[model samples]
Target: MNALPRREAPWAPTALRELRRPWKLATFALGLGWLLYGALNYGIADWDVGISLLMGGLTYLLASWSVGRLAQLRRPDAIGLAVALAALFAAWYCVDGVYVLYHGLAGNRMDREGNFRASLLLYFLAGMIWFYRGGLAELRRDLIRLIPRT
Candidate 1:
């Protein structure tokens, strides 16, 4: 029996291939932005910087995994998944904000160090999520190219 010709996915365009190379750079910039925000807002506390670095590393890992999964799945709806992830991130931020407000109402000091630390972490998470969205957008564009036009 003759072997079937290997199908090259039409959506895997060279432009998309080039885009993947910049993801790491984008991630790095995101990490740096988080660090700068923390330094500016919190005055470079040791623990805050350490936690921000740790969170940035975690964000990078999550973004890498999501990108890999998107590449493996040729479906044109990866953008939906990206949007869902973004929503989840925002929800978490809102919950955290409410918690902080509750603590403030409970008579916690307004200038508590912990609150500033938490804000640093939140800023880091926000920057990382923004970068992740950028990467997802590129992936979505590639997936869109895969759909066969009628």
Candidate 2:
């Protein structure tokens, strides 16, 4: 008989291991480069740019934690679908941000009505996501129960 010894976990990576990943390190370097470029071109006086980047980074990392938790589910298709939809949302926001920033720098502003409409649309989309989160949580619970323990 060659039965393996019982282990207690569901073990995951250590914080250090996560930080040392090559992809993570590369992203960190890229982020620093972007910050350096921004400082040089936009100047250190641009609080908006700095704050925006910081907030975006925090949001991104926090969101990853949520997704990482979901990654444990047996049915991974839900995770993939969530990622795809979120990517689309992020892409739309990125394009809109670029458009707005370009116009702003060129001394033109976004049309007030259009901006308001877009804001409303974004709000609705976010609301829908908030609603969907409940279902995702329920699904996670169900899937976890379905997973057989060692």
Q: How many angstroms is residue 55 displaced in model 1 relative to the true structure, after the best TM-score fit?
A: 1.2
What tens digits encode model 2's per-residue C-alpha lDDT throughout 49-140? 54335433433333333333333334547655565456445434433554456456756535535544643353333323321222345646
Taken over the whole model, the C-alpha lDDT of each candidate is: 0.45, 0.42
Give the local distance difference test score of model 1: 0.45
Measured with C-alpha atoms, the lDDT of residue 124 in candidate 1 is 46
TM-score of each: 0.31, 0.30
What ranges in model 1 sit over 4 Å off? 1-20, 43-47, 63-150
Q: Give one clash count per candidate, in the order shown.
A: 0, 0
Which window of ten consecutive residues has the lowest lDDT sum in model 2? 1-10
Report the lDDT of model 2 for residue 23: 51
The weakest ten consecutive residues by lDDT in model 1 span 1-10
Identify the runs in model 2 with alpha carbons over 4 angstroms from their true place.
1-13, 39-49, 56-63, 72-150
